[model samples]
Target: MLYRLMKYVLLGPLLRLFWPAKVTGLENIPAEGGAILASNHLAVADSFFMPLRVPRRVTFPAKQEYFTEKGVKGTLKKWFFTGVGQFPIDRSGGSAAQAALDTAIRLVREGHLLGIYPEGTRSPDGRLYKGKTGVARIALEARAPVIPVAMVGTDKVNPIGSRMWRPRRLEIHFGKPLDFSRYEGLSGDRFVERSITDEIMYALMELSGQEYVDIYAAKAKELLAAEAAGARPAVPAQTSGARDAARLPESKAG
Candidate 1:
């Protein structure tokens, strides 16, 4: 297919010539099987560079907005992602999240290599953030192994505002797979899911060597943007009497 041709025949050689990289831990990857490649997302190029390093094809969930943009650029992006076997799904709605998870589970069952960024979004400051539980959910639900990967120096290759990738010294490190087989049938337990997700994040932190921040990347970006805009931080609602020491008096019945 065109995807294989692009990955192995066409683009593969071109990348070797222009974007040569040192990839380690290939032995950690199964020659053939369903597994999750969970990694710290540094830049947009992580999507392409990660898959390009592995001999096996990787499929990742993409934002629907990427495929729905309103211009020739959007069309090209849609075509590229589609041709590379990436599919877009809604990420905001609860039902849509479940739908995307189901799609991932199906891919795992089909023995496809699934690449996931537990951080859910690119790190705004290149620091590793707490991972979302979706990775754990997918791994547990599909009974697949999760491999922690680290992409080094990719942000420099394709940093924010960069339209195209510039040649850089990129490295791909694949760590040992984290097995969650003991948590079988516990996917419905949120605490279990969190524990699994946290374990995966720990592995990523060790592999990536990036400073760890106990917050989601997207939320951290929001806070940074809010601070930049000089917006007042919202106050939490008072839920207890002690928290309502300055509460207004209630009106008596007239």
Candidate 2:
């Protein structure tokens, strides 16, 4: 309906005309079934170019702000995102991560191609940053395969602060599907989740050829913002009653 109409009639031609993708290993995409497409986010257009080029309709969670504006323009923005199969979600608050995980698991279980930026946000400087464990949690909970996808040169079309998209060539590459069934039923194990996330990230790095940064993108952004403000980044508060898997020994991961 709306998805097909946009792709076949409206945005498909425009996207291809402006920033056509030279994709490789698209056969890696499963013909039919639930799977997580875990990609490295480098540009705002990664959302656009991705769904446009893929044969199947892909849905990703977008920021709630995109749907909350109070005007005709805001209405249109909401329409466009909804038309293209995207839904809005709040990206803040303490429960946000759990909410997102729940949404992703639901989507995958319902047999939709869920596109997730494992980095959680766009790369601040084109370097592939550490993936959060939420992706692994979703994959394990949904019992779905996670496919590592890489979109290259998208930053040039839609850089961090650029208002207008500049036409540029882009490349999309899909790596082999990563199965985490060996660690099935262990979604609650943060160490195991970290292992799964790291494995997917390793494949993404190889496909995108971006420098790898082992820290989360959000943390990196916080550090950069703090530095610009002439303030040292605030250290994270320790959990009162939760075990920090980061401090756990590797041998105990099993």
Candidate 3:
């Protein structure tokens, strides 16, 4: 009850006022039943903004730290996330990933909308990276349509290192649902996982128009952090001459 009230009456209105979002292709989202909204992660605010645009309550997996903190802040964080329908997922590898996948599958099976970012972390350079195969696995297991959502200009609103949000023009484009019914039972095969993941990433690439890097999100984050900290020497201009020479096309939506 609180979640619905807050979403419609308070949080949603305030977010729209500040961010001034323009949403497109909202009809692509299923009005009823279960589905997966696979989006490109560009900033921390992506989670909040995406949910506010969607009419139904979309539940996303949040890092366990949000729920494990201590004292007054911890309690507030727990309540806030819970009220917003986000559940904690242990991000550590091995059993944790499996557990998170299980939780997501259970939610979808129960007719809930599951929001997942295939990159698994916020993109540092605002470029879309390769999607992790977990999303493909879940979609296949749950037999849910995966809606590709692209968020533009969110990084400008709340870029990394900024303490507060800056009013910016945010736009969310929802691409037509990508159906993977043909790969229904092949979720266990590694090759199938990779193929499905690649397909999803390709659809996102068309929607987001960001340079696609075939690397995981964690590695990119580490490299960016190290570069920012000056621990690693900066790449000389000469070394990047080849990449610099190439003319990259700007995103039409951005």
User: Per-residue lDDT of 107-167 in model 3, one digit per residue for the tens?
Assistant: 9988999999998888877877767889988988999999999999989988888899999
Q: Check candidate 3 and list the clashing pairs.
A: none
lDDT of 2 by residue, 84-192 (tens): 8898888788698578779989999999999999898988878788788888899999999988899999998899999999999999998899888877789898778
Error of 2 at 8 (Å): 1.5
Model 1 residue 8 distance off true place after TM-score fit, in angstroms: 2.3
For this target, which candidate reaches the highest lDDT against the unseen true structure?
A: 2
Q: For residues 151-176, could you state the per-residue lDDT of candidate 1 as single tens digits?
A: 99989988987898899879999999
Whole-model lDDT for model 2 versus the true structure?
0.83
Candidate 3 wrongly placed segments (more than 4 Å): 226-254
Task: Give TM per candidate.
Answer: 0.86, 0.88, 0.88
Ranking by lDDT: 2, 3, 1
Report the backbone clash tally of model 1. Answer: 0
Please tell me which model should have the higher lDDT, number 1 or number 2. Answer: 2
| Model 3 poorest 10 in a row by lDDT | 245-254
Error (Å) of candidate 1 at residue 17 is 1.9
What local lDDT score does residue 17 receive in model 3, on the 0 to 100 scale?
Answer: 85
Estimate candidate 3's alpha-carbon lDDT, on a 0 to 1 scale: 0.82
Flag clash pairs in model 2. Answer: none
